[model samples]
Target: MTTEQSWWRRNRWPVLALAVLLPGTVILTTSSEWFDYQNGLYSHAVTVPDGQSAVYGGAEFRVDDTVLVRGGTEGGDELELDPDMDLIVAVLEVTPGKDLVDSCNLTISATSPAHPEKRTWNANVDLPRKFPPTGDSQTTCSDSQGEPYRLVVAATVPSGAAETSSWVQIEKIGLTPNYLELELSPSAVSSASTSSDISSSSTSAVRRDDLRQKSNATASRLTRTGSTIRSITNPIG
Candidate 1:
């Protein structure tokens, strides 16, 4: 064979192998990078200390405190809890920034390290009231003119579920998913447990009355301020 033919024959197999392997390697590398980018872009989880503030999706989220109530409330009315279930109430303040927040999208969840399961509950944005006056009424996070509004969210979980290492997750629903993971402080859980146990039985009636009065006052104040307390069709998932 000629010198040119000899050179081609010698290099052809290696060149073919390189052409096949290079494309596959590039495709895999590109796919992995794209997957990572998608994960980072679509959802982000931020860990925040209890009683601190964090910003997500252009909204300011502050978890003021958490309370565990032995009883539950519904539609501004108080209700007795099943002996097995207790209410996990979290008080939050959210400041809207140029975007209208669908209050129904705000949700809370509690997860115990001891227990792998997570318990989640929808938020009652119209607070200190438990629920909206009508089915169509909804609470929204609109521009408050530099004022922050209070949002109280309660989830009924099993007694003794609020323990150390337990955490509460707050989700702000929108195109981009963002979550605030707040560690439940041991002191707060212990205090809530002790107080709830005491108030669960002997003082429940008095507590309900007091809560009702507070709800009424809050509703009146919001109404005077032209705050929105309407309900929407967003269901808790």
Candidate 2:
């Protein structure tokens, strides 16, 4: 009857088709996420205790220990942190699964009630040896005799950042995601505090020298073993 009515009449079929398709498209696009959630894939965080191993995506990961250092060396080079920053290093033991992990990624953050600002940093991963070891030592990822590799991940953050928070979060890289919220045990916290106190006291110079020597020795060993050290970008919060 009118121009508006004429236009609607002409577009009616297309409008109906869109209405019918939109809901179906949404359902189709969201089905996989819903299915994964229902199957427990998107559920609870897997909390692996310190010094224990957890398997994810067929790979075995173990958090062996953690240390607080002023800074450290990697690949025969000194890696010094900023004056206000402290380095937290973790020792990880990894055994590859089906895939040969070329690199590992992680994030470390410090929370403090007084500060209220989060201090977070990405880890710089250092592998102990060349992967897929050459010669007779070579073994498949699944082999029982597979040689486990050690990795040192260092995170540099504000000096007192970790003292306020008891948990440090770690996320493994890749599609099949894995998370580790490592508990900063009392002993670990105490150790960090003790180190901090030593740095602030008159004996700081001596402590720093000692740490430098230790770091150099560590770097020498890693350099000789053909270890690989790579720094990864920080994760988007």
Candidate 3:
């Protein structure tokens, strides 16, 4: 037999198997990449208006109350806030459809009445030292007590956040690509019109300071020549 013919006869099955499997492996990898790309492109926010409820992740959630608590030094766990930062608390009434409660993350999106720009603040997971307590309520969705319960979430925001219209957003864990935003209505805990008005200058200063501090601590530290050598935190959201 010829040398080429002899080699082909000995390895024909293995060569054919590789030819078939290589394309399938490429397709499998590309299919997952396509799915992730579509999810990133199509993810959107569904706004649940005030006094309304939205069902997500087998749970019905309604924004019961949204309070902008100002001038207090309430802390949670090991986290302490700047005196210029106020607390924006949202109380949600969540009813789980099944026995298992869904886990969710909370965020506060506030738009300044004066500036018309949106700012987002993530909920602090720490239990506050002294907060406007909701009796027997759970701080997270996973800590449900087998029935409808209030879930409290708080974010430390700039001092004059009371002047901004805010919404509480709930992103269900394991069920992604979209999130629910609950509109905050006018609360009985009156807005601090005076504090917000007078503290606007100080609030701007505080925001600049916060940005400077976070840039120094969380953002990548650069060399003297201004090239980043190591990143301290993930910049992607």
Q: TM-scores across all candidates?
A: 0.56, 0.48, 0.56
lDDT of all the models against the reference? 0.49, 0.46, 0.55
Model 1 lDDT per residue over 13-73, tens place = 9989999999989998899887667655535557665545666555666554445555432
lDDT winner, 2 or 3: 3
TM-score of 3: 0.56
Ranking by lDDT: 3, 1, 2
78-171 per-residue lDDT for model 2 (tens digits): 2334555565555455665654445434656667666667655765533222111222311122224445665544466665677665344544
Better candidate by lDDT, 1 or 3: 3
Model 3, position 83: C-alpha lDDT score? 62
> How far out, in Å, is residue 106 in model 2?
2.1
Candidate 1, lDDT over the whole model: 0.49
**Pairs with steric clashes in candidate 2:** none
Instruction: Give one clash count per candidate, in the order shown.
Output: 4, 0, 0
